[model samples]
Target: MQKYWILSLALCSAPLVSAQSLMVTSFDSIAYVNSHNGIQASAHISVKNTSASVKDYRLLRSRIGTTGLVDSNYFCWDLCYPIWVNQSQGTVTIAPGATANDFSGYAYVRDTSANGQDSIWYTFVNTSDANDSLQVMVVYAFNRYVSNSESSLPLLSVYPQPALAGQRIYGIPTDALKLEWMDLAGRVHQVITQNDGSITAPSAQGIWILRAYFQNGIRTTRVLLR
Candidate 1:
């Protein structure tokens, strides 16, 4: 039987409105969450800046999920903090009473497999000064069904979250398998032979599902490109 864990994509709004150099104003439209070994989840993100001064900042997005009855938390964001790993970075200047949108990359969650609740968190950093301040926006997505494909025997892997045209994905164990690229409309667009365990994603917009089949079985995963 394929193990399906239910996760809730709950949206809780909190404002880090303070006298800091950086702040996380809001997060919206987070979905298609994925996890592996009951540990991590990754997805797309949108960020807005709300702070005083011409804030030169970066946005880091990450997820911390449940592990068992006891959950494990892994983070992929902008700063190399104790709780999260830095994934991507960009500089934006937030004018007083102005906001900036960051749609740069993927938010990865690590070690999220506990059959409990999970939370997605974001951090804003002021890159202009090392001594500058930071803020966090943590939202919990509850009652989600984690897929069997995410933690299958073959251990498939994908890369460059917020993937581009040129990035590579690997971890399939053999050849003689087929790769299919499908859209949400139930249409298959690209089919390529799986060779040397990995393949490059096409240069396209929106979300794509990649499926692979081997002598043993089949597995599927998701990627986002913009």
Candidate 2:
């Protein structure tokens, strides 16, 4: 069976009298099924300037473990920067107390092994001085198992089709492994893994996707909130 591995890393710059400090505020993990074509994951990285002065920084370098791989092409926020094989990207300046979001891109794993571990490291440096920098690293591991012969997944049920505010929706299903709720933007809203098969609707009025992972595969259903 196919499985996904996810890891998140948060880094804050060192405190120096003359140097500007930046902290990673929205770093999250992503996962996808491994296939012969390739294993891919989409991630969003963001940082905020916590210092008193404006700071100019550049993505100095990025390194991926031998087991995992990332392509040179990536989509950035202000611009679409192309990453070379050496893993170098463009630069940006952040105002004091301001945040830079939109470091979104795709990561890939070429190896289709049964089990393995890999890591990705991203280093950012001050444009003025190379000595001032910060590094963030993410480690991930995954294992694949034999797929079950059954072709159909277990039936899943959710109560109160149009869930109301402050209402907890009960999800009923057999042999459930995990459940995750995410908004349309792909941001994870909530996760439940005890196999109790219950989730609470978010206060926002919009459409959300509920994904239920089982031993064999995954099932997704759309949920609406009022």
What lDDT would each prediction earn against the true structure?
Answer: 0.47, 0.56
Give the per-residue lDDT of model 2 (tens digit) for 1-226.
Answer: 2223343332232232233486777764433334332344444567788877887877633666674344322333334344443333457888889987635444444455635545556566777777766666654443354231233766555878878855788755757777777665444567778765567778788777566777655555667788
Off by over 4 Å in 1: 1-25, 28-53, 60-89, 103-114, 130-132, 137-226
180-212 per-residue lDDT for model 1 (tens digits): 675533245677884777777767778776656
Q: Which one is best on lDDT?
A: 2
> If scored against the real structure, what TM-score would every candidate get?
0.37, 0.47
Error of 1 at 114 (Å): 7.0
Point to the candidate with the largest TM-score.
Answer: 2
